[model samples]
Target: MFHIETEIRLVGPSMKTIKVSSRIECAMICSNDNCCSSSYDTILEHCSFFRDCCPSKEFSKESQTLTKISGFNPPPKDCSELPAESCSGVYVIQPENRPSMTVFCEMSIDNGGWTVRNDYLHFILRQRSYQVRFDLEDFTGNTSYAVYSTMYVGDESDNYKLKLTGYNETAGNGMSNFGGSSLSGMMFSTRNRDNDIDERSCAISRKGAWWYQSCAAANINGVYSQKYSNSAVYWRSWREKNGQKKTMMMTKPKP
Candidate 1:
């Protein structure tokens, strides 16, 4: 059976569009074809079919509606496998051996196809090779970023060991401090999970989860604070103070 949603529209490019008499007809056509998802415009009596295994959804103020037919193929592993016209938004993905999840894609950045990191970071990284990008913004409104050619994180059973290399110096290697002995090869540490070599839990001491050695030389997941401190978002190689206003870790399949 297929599920239908009213006043909800699929937000990506449609592979085909045709005039239909009703929503049922639209769904029937999509069900017969290999398309996994489709949408229908009630007022215009139009039907649109998408090739995306799982497309992004958005509430529509118009008469448009979307549908998801069951028994179709599984969703893509990452945003890079999506169509070139896919927009920046939340889409469903299923990494190898992992449950389906909704993740935001940064489509506006460098021709799009970037998957924002979430709790499934390890699962996504372990599924395949991906190039990682770090975006940082300071309280002064200045922004800087660093891109690595390769990044891999082991599964939980392996302590989520981090591996990074191939720094692109053109973007200013602010992550150099993190790619050193301080973080590379280190297991991830969190507030409740202690995996660092430090005598104490770095996550509890620093107020964030990260791959830490004795503590951290650079931590992008630190707490957001107005003042500089060991618990605030910071990249020591770029600035001594934790005056960061924003930070983002994004990944995409390496070209």
Candidate 2:
């Protein structure tokens, strides 16, 4: 039997941690199936997940930081000994009102069709978009790797370039608790037009924090290592292009 636990946390604009009562609720599933797939709904009230899910709130003039949740577990006391990656960066925003992020990669022919799975983590704030690039030398037979990527802009505006910043990679040994396989980034953010140039705005320069987990990577770890975060993951063994492989994050299919 497989059990999946979920947790959500919300931080105040002032960086204050807010506690909220929340639990995972099952919307639909199939049980005792007789072959035909049927629809059903169930509520799991005993879900012991407790955290601050900073529910949707109006943007206030007060400048504050969002709590960056790095992983399913809490961070270690001493980060100096861990091999962490920069989890945030200033990305060129493809202004839109959808996905808010995307992943990019090149097609591969060495392996069969491959699949890429991603998770949107809200460590600091939900990322406005997720754009990952993969090498497609094998699939496209190109002399160089081309970027196949997607873009999920937020609802803020159809014309605004977002600047993503903070980035933290987990420890290499697989003991990253407040860590998982998820990458994090900034959500939809724009200029505070209400404020004057002399006023303090964009108070926090740090990128919205969070993490990303590849569904493909987590599946491979089962056979290789014991420690979770540091162990080998699905990214190492994705098929070249026989199945569910992502070429890029474009508005439509590539030419």
C-alpha lDDT values of all predictions: 0.70, 0.22
lDDT of 1 by residue, 1-255 (tens): 112333454577788889986544565577677676566665566788877756676665454343343321668788787777554445678888888876666665777788874668888887778898988777786777788888888888988888888877433554533445535687888888898887888899888888888887667788887578888888776766565877778999888
TM-score of 2: 0.17
lDDT of 2 at 247: 23
Positional deviation of residue 254's Cα in model 1 after best superposition, in angstroms: 0.9
Provide the lDDT at 6 for model 2. Answer: 18
Instruction: Write candidate 2's Cα lDDT for 16-130 as tens digits.
Output: 2122211101101111111111111112222111123232334322211111122322232111111233111111122123332322111122221111222222211132233
Candidates in order, TM-scores: namely 0.67, 0.17
Cα-based lDDT at residue 16, candidate 2? 21
Task: List ranges where model 2 is wrong by over 4 Å.
Answer: 1-72, 75-131, 139-144, 147-151, 155-255
**What residue pairs are clashing in model 1?**
none
